[model samples]
Target: MIEEIPSEPVVITHIIHETPSIRTFEFSRRFEAQAGQFCMVWVPGVDEIPMAFSAGNAITVQKVGEATGALFSLTEGDVIGIKGPLGNGFSPEGRVLAVAGGVGAAPLRPLVTYGQADTFILGARTAEELLYAGELAGKAEDLRIATDDGTRGHHGFVTALLEEADPASYDTICVCGPEMMMKAVLGILDAHGVADRGQFSLHRYMKCGVGICGSCCFDSSGLRVCRDGPVFTGDVLLRSSEFGRYSRDAAGRRIPF
Candidate 1:
């Protein structure tokens, strides 16, 4: 039976080591999750963090810092608390272009899987970090990769890949990646003569998964990312000078990228 994610720990029935630094934790059963929404994961004794579901039963994680390191160390049958499908989600329409950087593919994978066939430009530091390429390929009409190390496909940023794409071919672009990368994406879109009709995910410091905490708001407009969106259109992004410029930290202090 489908289960509701709860505050209490739930068993991780299986695990898939996607790459050296990335792993997928599979829960006992499927839980509802929209393509762009996230789950608040509590790693007992370590810390709580937000994760995006790659599939109903699985959430992919990149072992970056302390909390993620503890998350990746989890073995089969280990229980961890999870609560979500929270936040606004992406909705695909017409023709779509999806770009993902490293583990950012975790969320976009579901979008391509459930939506109409689309194209993708997935980038990472190296070939090994280019996540879900094989899985995403099956769902994508065109699959391209940009690696910083030139170990795989194009030897440049994903924005370079975006630059080469005929912007007119697709109705819109959707991106999720580093703040700097998304900022570069905006510049590329402007140069390509594409209207700011695209959409992208904005990652901010989120404490409460709900809107109670004011941590994830735009600097000026006060639009809440956790509630109003984690995904916003290019038009919305254009209005906020803070879109790719800076993000608030745990204490709500602006940190420039």
Candidate 2:
């Protein structure tokens, strides 16, 4: 079972507006989390949502639905329940390529901090959605940004920029994003014959992040997302048909990806 951290209500000390819909909330105290560890956040009467831990006990929240909406509605002094630093995290070294899509940059940011050196590629639907540009600049050896629209950087998916990059220069690649985006990244690496050098972070609906309810388990393999991962090696992901193909909802029903 995964352990929950803080063990008490945590107060929000500060907040940074990353985008109109995304915000990074800093807790009153540091959580000592790792590169890819996540926290189960409980918001009073609202729902509990899992979020990747950012720097200094912070968690970036993107207002995507009711749960996030409720979380975002809180004021600076508001308190929330936090449970985690759960699951495995990245241990990247040497020349690294850190890839992020949309709010997926939240988790990768900590990974970059841990690595201390990396080339970061951040993407979003528009330039406005691109996050942590300056923060990443201080940590990344090189930083690239992309948007689907012509709003910023490359006028296409970040993967397009990645293709133009000399992937052979990096010892490893760490990626987190929408399933489709991750799939595309995997494909590009495969085509370039560097598939083995990638690590992918995946998301699925969760009820109990401690691996008790078995809600985050994958089909066929019995691998629990809350326990076995949220992050997986390129080899494990490549071999799993479900990697980019399917997921379960809150009801544990198979849903095509």
Candidate 3:
């Protein structure tokens, strides 16, 4: 039987800086989360943001804005609220190549930790900005790295690295990153005729983690991202016009594309 877990406010106990602009928050939760699932983290006085789980069963947050910045300022036992292990995550059932760009590495970490038939390709703009390299390198079968400034392993975009790889060697590909990067990867997958077999995590600015808010809705299928996915198959991704576009926040104001 599937046990239903209730969402509630919890206290944050720790914070770690994964990079200059990125930090990870450690929060206590009893619920078990799948690899790519995310949670809506609520700051008492600020807005709640959807963050992906990095460590299993723990909420790891990267400092990006007001809520996240407030989260980073918190100390041990600081009170915070959380709502879910929301959205679909990566399911690496076959030979998989997991690709992560910038902070995108966080959500994909769990799959690398527990799932099988996986390899990892991690990228950042610089060596200092690269997160989870050591951990992913240890867990993944084959690990590759790329940076925009030539400060790390390969000097180029991760998509360039993907283009050079043999797509047939892997049964599936999992990707998460900036919209442009994911879109570029998707294009490469298409040219290689492997688009149908890949999975992508769509990063969007979300207000309510639940479907009712409609803050994360995409017009193409009228799909609510919070309810339908933060993760989708490449074929499904291709069908959504909103994949590369910006979405609205709770205020119904346009963010940016």
Candidate 4:
């Protein structure tokens, strides 16, 4: 039976600096979440933000927004509230291909560590921004890197690498990255007549992690990223008019991507 796990306080027991801008905070509590699932992390006296589990008991955080900045300021033994294992996750089929960009690697890390990805393509702005590259290299059967600054492997966008890949070669192609990148990847998959095999994880503004707020709902289909999915199939996303066009801000204002 799927039972709801209530919000509870968790203590940070360890911290691993994954990148200059990203850190993984480990907690004592083991959250049994799948590769694509996320949790609502509450920073006391600050804000609650949705975070994907980077590991079994850790959240890889990039120092970005206010909530994340607050999380960065924290150290070992600091307490935080966690309320999830929420939403659906990727159920890896055969011969999975995983693609990630920037911090999007956090969620896909678990999948890679599970030995799910037969091939993994990772991209970031620079070499330093590539999260878990070393670990992922040891995990995935094949690992490729792309950097915008030419500090590492391919000197271009990750989508450039995706373009070289045969989408139909893999049974499932899971992607989590910047919206524009994912959109482009989706186009590639569609052109290859394998859109059904593509799974894209979306990043949307969310106040409440649950479906009640409706803040994360996109246009047309009105799918809630928090509830329905942070991970959506390429075909479903193609049907949504707002998927790549725009997203709502915290104030419900339409922000074009």
User: Which candidate achieves the best lDDT against the true structure?
Assistant: 4
The runs of at least 3 residues in candidate 2 whose Cα sits more than 4 Å from the true structure, single-residue gaps closed, are 1-6
Ranking by lDDT: 4, 2, 1, 3
> Candidate 2, overall lDDT?
0.83
In TM-score terms, candidate 2 sits at 0.94
Q: Give TM-scores for every candidate, taking all chains together and pairing residue i with residue i.
A: 0.92, 0.94, 0.91, 0.96
Local error of candidate 4 at residue 173 (angstroms): 0.7
Clashing pairs in 2: none
lDDT scores of the candidates, listed in order: 0.81, 0.83, 0.78, 0.90
Please report the candidate that would top TM-score against the real structure.
Answer: 4
**Greater-lDDT candidate between 2 and 4:** 4
lDDT of 2 by residue, 1-257 (tens): 34444545899988899988799999986877778788889889987778889775799989989989898888899999888778877667678888999889988998677665468899999888888877877777789988999798889998888887877677888888889999999988888888888878788899877788898887667788888888887777777868788998888788997
Off by over 4 Å in 4: 1-5
Candidate closer to the true structure by TM-score (higher is better), 3 or 4:
4
**Candidate with better lDDT, 1 vs 3:** 1
lDDT of 1: 0.81
Q: Write the residue-wise lDDT of candidate 1 on 123-201 in tens digits.
A: 9999988898778767687898899999999998998888788765778787888978887887777666664757778
